[model samples]
Every structure is written in C-alpha cells, then in structure tokens.
Target: MAAPDRPAGGGRMLTGVTWAVLLLGLWLWGRDITDGSGGPAPTTGDVAAVGRPIGVRLPPAHAPLRAAVPERVEIPSVGISAPVVPRGLDRGGGIEPPSFDTPQTVGWYDGGTKPGAAGAALLVGHVDTETRPAVFYPLSAAHPGEQVRVVRSDGSVAEFTIDDVQVFTREHFDAQKAYGPRKDGRAELRLITCGGTYDRATREYTANVVVSAYLTGGSGAAA
Candidate 1:
C-alpha cells in the first residue's frame, strides 16, 4: 500500500537536519557570525563584492565574548520580569539551561556567539515549570512593538521592540529563515521556547514559538 504521508515525514526529517546543520555551522564560525559588531574590519572592496553588509572580524582571542548582561526584561502584555544571563550551547547542540541554579533568568548561547552582531542573537527560556513558573511563560501571547529591555553590566541597556511572533513545527523549524539574512545593518534578536500542544508520548511540545525583534535603542555596549 502506498502511504500518502510518507513523503511528508521524509521532508520533515530533511528540514530538521538542515536546520541543525546551519546552526552548527554558525557556531563553528563564531568569528564570522559576530563579525557584524566590528570585530574583523572588512574592506570596502569586500563589502562591494558581497553587495551586502559584512561584519568586521576580530581576533579570536580578543573577540568580544562577554554577554550583554540584562538587568530586566519587561513584556507589558505577558507580565514577564526577570534578569538575563549568557547561555551556552549543550553537547547535544540545543540551548543549555539558562542557569544551573535559578533557571529563571534567560540565557544567550555562549558557544554560538552573541546577538546584535551579524547573525541571530538567540535568547531562550522555560515556558513553565512543574512546580513553579519561570521566565518567558507568556511569550506566546506577545504582540508586535512590545518592549523588551536588556540591561548590560556596563551601565547601558539594550531595548528591543518586538516585530513579529512565529510558531513553527518542531519537524519543520528553519534556522536560515528564522536566523539568516537581514536587509538592514542593524542588530536582531530571537526569543525561542517550546509551545503548541503538548505530546505526552514524546514528552515534548508540538511546536516552537519564536519572537523576533530589532534593536531600537540602547546605551552602554554595542551588543
């Protein structure tokens, strides 16, 4: 018997693998990823060749690895209030827990590179907990132009205004579409967490909701 959905399943697997590979490549090329923040200075000729913005790459040793310490995150509609931490990648390639102890503050993936440079600056948090609630619990309900404030350690704050919220099936998550190219030379941010219906058998959510925004204004540091 021919199964109509067999092709769909295969396509989903391929999409998942491709997304995973793109993320891995970004992590491996952290220099190029964060080069947008004036790390490696690209020549005028180089920029002309690409016909797009190219981030300046800095020496690996001197690369700005320090995360932009967030003092607070305010989502008026969702009523979210918490601190942000620098998050790193896990051995399995997924985002590591934002914090080992609190698990309430959001974390930026350290391994992948910082946000606001060239590539996507990924911020992730728990939607909820078994015993108590956590940050990003109400993320799925956020609307466009909502404010997200991130205070850094250098006495500056990065304010982001939400542009859109998108929900993607776990089987069809696309990294390039989610974190790839941007026309403007401005920095971008992405907030991700599990959402959609819960699958008890798999013990996972059916989809992931991503909130993307651009850096509107800030003080202390660049990223």
Candidate 2:
C-alpha cells in the first residue's frame, strides 16, 4: 500500500538540529572506524531489555573477512532481497541514500567500512515509496537470531546474525549505538530505515528502526 505524500526533498532527513545531530554522528562514525575499536555494546536505549530479545541464543562472530564491495543484501525472513548501491556523503556531510526512483534498492556508505570488514557496515533503505511499500518496509518485523546476508564482489557471502532491533526517536537517537561496532573484533552490519509513527505535519517518520548484526557463518572466500 502507498504512504502519505513525502516532502519534495525526500523521505528520511529530519529537521534542523536533529538533522545536524545525525549528520555529525555519521561524520564521526566514518572518521572513527578502525579494524578493532573498544566501542560500547550495541543496544537500543528505549527498550528495557536493551535491544536483546528474551533468551534468544545468538551465534559467536566469525573472524572478519577482507574488504569487498557489496553486491546485494538478503533477509529471507522478511522477504527482502535487493541490489546494493554504493553511496557517499552529501554536501551536508550526511550519508546519502539511493534516489527515490530506486526505492527497491539499498544504499551502502561507500566511504565507511565495507560489509565483511572489521567494522560495522552500514546499509540503508526506504520503508516505503510514494506508491507502495519499499525494500525495507518490513524491516522492523525482523527479530533477533534471524540472518542478514551480504553477497560481496569477492564471491563470498558475509553472513551476519541479528542480535538487536531498535527504534530510536529523533530526540533519543544515539548514532554511535546505532552505527558503531557492537564487538571490537568482528564484522558488523547496521540496517536502517524510517519507522515509527508518521508525522503528517512534518512529512517524516518520528523514529528510525536500526537492526544490529555481526558476522556469523558464511561460505566462499574473500578476494
């Protein structure tokens, strides 16, 4: 089904200070990425359980694979399988998502850590389009323990095991928690999309849904 009309600018950007904060966080995240950084544990602040589901057993992280361009992403449980395109920062220093014309596509931050690398790899998609549900519209429904696979250009698949699902309101958005590495020595992934209640007045979603996962098991070899 279709959603309400979006602003002429686009679907994801927030307003004024909130937008600035997101941009700053993203910029710092890009600059701070390293093979292994003793970062904080990944958790959603609003959830009492702190992003972990009750008693779900997650797998241990696999050693990080070499850097390679991502070709596609697949989340079988949610029926998401889409082409991934590399994107860079916009003039305002914010990671630019795919153009609205390609709502079925996912955008990867080209300047940041690549999927299967030592740091968290960032992927973003649209929740919906002007005419229908987009690639990651059902992303919030994904649960911990599910798998997110990123097929890389090196002919290997980087398999990430979901450990957390979080929804951060603009006021409570913690970019580091959302974008940083969950564990210091493993490959991680961050899936993000617009979510929560839609604000007609602002023409935006009130929050962003972030899914955190780390490298689990995969087949093939990295180049």
Backbone clashes in model 2, listed as residue pairs: none
- Best of the candidates, TM-score: 2
Question: Model 1, stretches more than 4 Å misplaced?
Answer: 1-71, 99-101, 112-119, 220-223
Sequence-dependent TM-score of model 1: 0.65
Can you give the lDDT of residue 3 in candidate 1?
18
lDDT of 2 by residue, 1-223 (tens): 2333455444443444434555666777876753333001123455322346678998888988888999999999878999999989988778776777888899999888899988888998877655567788878778899999999998999998998887766676677887988777788999877655666576666666778899997778872
lDDT for each candidate structure: 0.52, 0.75
**Per-residue C-alpha lDDT of model 1 across residues 1-223, encoded as one tens digit per residue:** 1111122212121123323543453354444455643001112321111112234321111122234544456666667777777766557654455542564678666655344444457777765444344576577667665676666666666666676566655455456555554434456677765454454344444555667766666656553
Report backbone clashes per prediction: 11, 0
Question: Any runs in candidate 2 off by more than 4 Å, and if so which?
Answer: 1-24, 34-52
lDDT of 2: 0.75
Give the lDDT of residue 5 in candidate 2: 41
Error of 2 at 55 (Å): 2.0
